[model samples]
Target: LADDGSRLWLNYDLIKDAKQRESYAPFTKFIAVASDNQTLKIATEELQTGLLGLLGKKIVTVKTATTSGGIILNVNKNAPSSANISNEGYEIYTEKGNIIISSKSETGVLYGAFELLRAIQTGKSLAKLSITSSPKVKIRMLNHWDNANGTVERGYAGSSMWKWNELPHRVDPRYVLYARANASIGINATSINNVNASSRFLTAEYLEKIKAVADVLRPYGIKVFISVNFRSPRTLGGLKTSDPLDPEVRKWWNDKTKEIHQYIPDFGGYLVKANSEGEPGPQDYGRTHADGANMLAEAMRPFSGIVIWRAFVYNADPNGDRFKEGYAQFKPLDGTFDPKVIVQVKNGPIDFMPREPFHPMFGAFPKTTLGMEFQITQEYLGQSTHLTYLAPMFKECLDTDTYAKGQGSTVAKVIDGSLYNAQYSLMAGVANTGSDVNWCGHPFNQSNWYAFGRLAWDHTLSSEQIASEWIRMTLTQAKPTEQKISDMMLKSHPIYVSYTYPLGTSHMMGESHHYGPEPWLAKSARPDWTSVYYHRADSVGLGFDRTGKLSNALQLYSPEVQQKWGNPEQCPLDYLLWFHHVPWSKKLSTGRSLWDELCERYYDGVVQVGNLQKTWESLKADVDPEIFENVKGRLKIQEKEALWWRDACVLYFGEYSKMPIPKPLTPPQ
Candidate 1:
């Protein structure tokens, strides 16, 4: 129990320095109080919990300054610097025999508390400390696609954490622990239920349960949101139809929102996945997505809540490419959505594969509020069976330039609202959490959750910075060892993508389970879900023809974007095949034919997986036994999966590419 990952990064291990301990002991001995509230109480409790574990001595709070040497939570005092300090900003320092932690806001005070714990965990001396930090993003949320039955969609980490049957009266200890972990990382809101929602969650009975969960999270400053079934008026409220423009449906939503507020005052509005994946929406009644979204927006406007309408729409047309579905559905209705309704778009058009180009709609919808929805769960990235750190993947999407207005318009700016200067901006991760003893099913997968929160807090923060911090905090801190582990994590995503879904091709995983390759499965009702539709690899060429001459998908982007990606030689190799369908013999920038390049990429992926495995093997003694063994076991699975992907993909593509494996290769198909 002591070595298991139950504590996550909140682990405040003991500091081990004789002289430095003497320097830090004065500050770690006391909790200075200037106010009272559940929030403040929580801050004190966390400080107490973190200190006693780290210093092995209880921290005593004094009404004034008891001893001349006590750590002071001086939040009520004026902050030192107003320049970088927002309300959610804080700084740590020592002066006049009191270690001072001051901030403009209570949340900032809590953050300072967490940092102090982190400093102690990393065995840094508290003397002469001056650290200031504030989140860059306004809203950071976790989207749980968990159902009423306690099952999480795409959740490889067992069932959902929320025990639906035992809520309202019964509180899980893990809920409190979970809230603390999130608050430590500045995750302010949690979209708890599935976006593919059930009307039952909106019912009064469930509201009580949701409220119970909220109470556990309230002290940590985390608000809970529920995803409402769009047709709730017709199904749950006994209305004739759930039309967005209809008076009855509008009134039903307004009253229902009011009822929800009566239970949890800080209930954080709705996350609707409407008219997508066969779910009913305004489109079902010949109304626009904006109409459906705006109805909910208007209903929640009075309560200061916002609606997050999902852009993961799938088309009913059997012939249409699913890759174009979200753009097709939302682009026309861009400016139509109410100001309170923010459109939530996934990072890519298709489901969360190992690799995908940033969604075109991220730049396409300039007039609307766009929120990023990234999947933190390794749903198709070998589930919890593989070790894949996703910070670089996140950075890849965030750093991608959209050129919507011009060249400087990056996806990170668009998501944080700097691009459009919108009042509210959101970044959501489809949570990789569960009831596992260690939270995320695989121990290393916890890095994804940590990275998401860190990035969401500040889009400017480098993934490398977050990885270094997480590795030291979550694991060991020997410089060479930390660097070694960080290198593995930082490169894990590319290695995974190289081995799994390289060249921007996606959704080759098994049809229903999404476990592995099914490149030949082309008969699914939705073409996008089928691998044959995306790759189109055959006798003549490979890759989908997204050009204007083919699917006209290139028309969705601005002229600059079309120019950037339209040409075969100029496009990034990561997405080289996504926009073009090139012949087997076409010479690439790598001086290899398209088939040979495919062979190289697929083989490169497998080799990288082996590289990650080897990197871990070399660091066996530097990391904790439990954590190292945990990742080692998972990386082994990743290697096996990598080989499975390599062999299976090469064998299948050979039937199409018709090229023998390079002369040196053994399996000369």
Candidate 2:
């Protein structure tokens, strides 16, 4: 059978190496279940299926391990003193001539089962296996931007995967496969609708459809969350006002939440996007963001649910640094939210740019639990067409030293609740999945989804390590092929950034669709919507100036951050344009004028895209024919688009710098 990407990284192709298979066949004698629960049953079945595919063996399930050289799923009611793991954590090791997958909860056993399968799939030596793993963030989730109309906002793949028109009674088997994929990656929570929510989802009719989804996901240890409309009381319940302070509105939400719980007992929680980009919120009724979130939190208090309030809000003032707005609005309200409320801040202050400095809110809101929201969809990158691996981008922000609690404080620590010892920690990815056979449009795009879940589970894993594992499991297992593809995957993001957002120039993509380059864009519906508003390109220089002279955005970060990024000479070149407005002729640390360096990066970026094409073509012998052709075609488009970006940006900015495209850097014919 041809390799269609529908299976994702869970592909269980039989082990071709006889010696490698012999090593794993010992554990296939039987899979013993310590406890028989719904989740444990799923774990047992998955292990059986994986063993059958990988070892060509039929494994039997037993109540307990009566013999040796088998796998045991042990759930310790009172966890062993030496086992340091959360309720959803697992400690897998070889013990008593049996490999034990021990956990405090059944879901942990399920995760461990997948981990064991992954080790085999990735050709890891399990001879002396001793692995202990847990999710770093309490809630690692995927936030879908799908609508009830079956269209996804900013979605570049196919139509929405929900099939909302056929639900409640006619559940699609795809939901089961989806749940299995998410469970394999340790994503325990998912919101089924767009954060720009529809009030219809709150209606009884749509609740039935959502309940159907929750049912399919529940057994896999995945919980369902809803992106709720703030004004649902007025829009759906015919209330006079949906004000958070209004008793009638409060009662309506309480009743609605209770009704939802009746249909789906484990409904995870609510995700809200309010008072920004035309979304209605508490501000419409003279209430702060806290008031709106707390009201929802109060309704969820009776249930074991949460309220994830988005902090992506910003004013339309072109003069205001939108970078500082999220901090300005929520920083003062720190330590003021209900225990159930978690502020979900985007990875960057602005929208998901090609390259962005870490959001200032990371360390600023020390009193609150802040969840990281990363866009796995390539809205500002190249959408589904370009092969851009986002793991590096995610790692860039995570590994960044926020200096929140001194030098070693990273964004990873902040969102994992270790920095200030917050109660909850979350990391959500805006999903890129759709109705495409591959789920994501491009075959390689699956890596972004895989990378997000893995990092959310353990932020310490390096991007290269994740890429290597993904390549071995999903693509070719050939060592030479894997190394070559990993190199291209690691470099893909920087290459895209080089042509599009080098030196932190951002919001330059075509205005509405957000594809291709448009740095010359000077007008849009809103002043802040225009590329010129962000790029500030002129005869003097290019890039935004967030210094106090223009906007006091730097004050939002710790003094360490401010001091580091304040001086033009001291700032890293990657983030230089984000904070400084240097003269076009000013020589950078690279020993070249700003214009020259900019031109070099743009020109070289196109050349690198050509190199990516060459790399993929060389792997044609090692990869699936269908997948190779698919990637080859996309790389062709990428190179053409890279040229489009290079010429357009270089020429447009050259109009201001009055500089040539530098020697040895000529535009494509």
User: What RMSD does each model have against the real structure?
Assistant: 2.5, 1.5
List, residue by residue over 83-126, the lDDT tens digit for candidate 1.
Answer: 67777778888778787788877777887888887787766767
| Model 2: residues with Cα > 4 Å off, grouped in runs | 80-83, 666-669
Return the lDDT, model 2, position 355: 86
Q: Candidate 2 lDDT, tens digit per residue, 1-669?
A: 779899898878787888989988776688999667999999999999888887888899999888898999988868765535788999889987788998888899999999999999999977789998878899999999999999999888899999999998899888988999999989999999999999989889999999999988998888999999998999889999999999999999999999999988988999999998999999999999999999999999989999999999999887788888898899889999998999999999999998898999998887889999999988988998998999999999999999989998999999999999889999999999999999999999999999999999999999999999899889867789999999999999999999888987889889799999998888888888988888888899987888888887888888999999988898988888988887899999998899999998998899889889988888888898889999999999998999899999999999999988778774543
What TM-score does candidate 1 get on C-alpha atoms? 0.95
In candidate 1, how many Å is residue 513 off?
1.6
lDDT scores of the candidates, listed in order: 0.83, 0.91
User: Candidate 2 has which clashing residue pairs, if any?
Assistant: none
Count of clashing pairs, candidate 2: 0
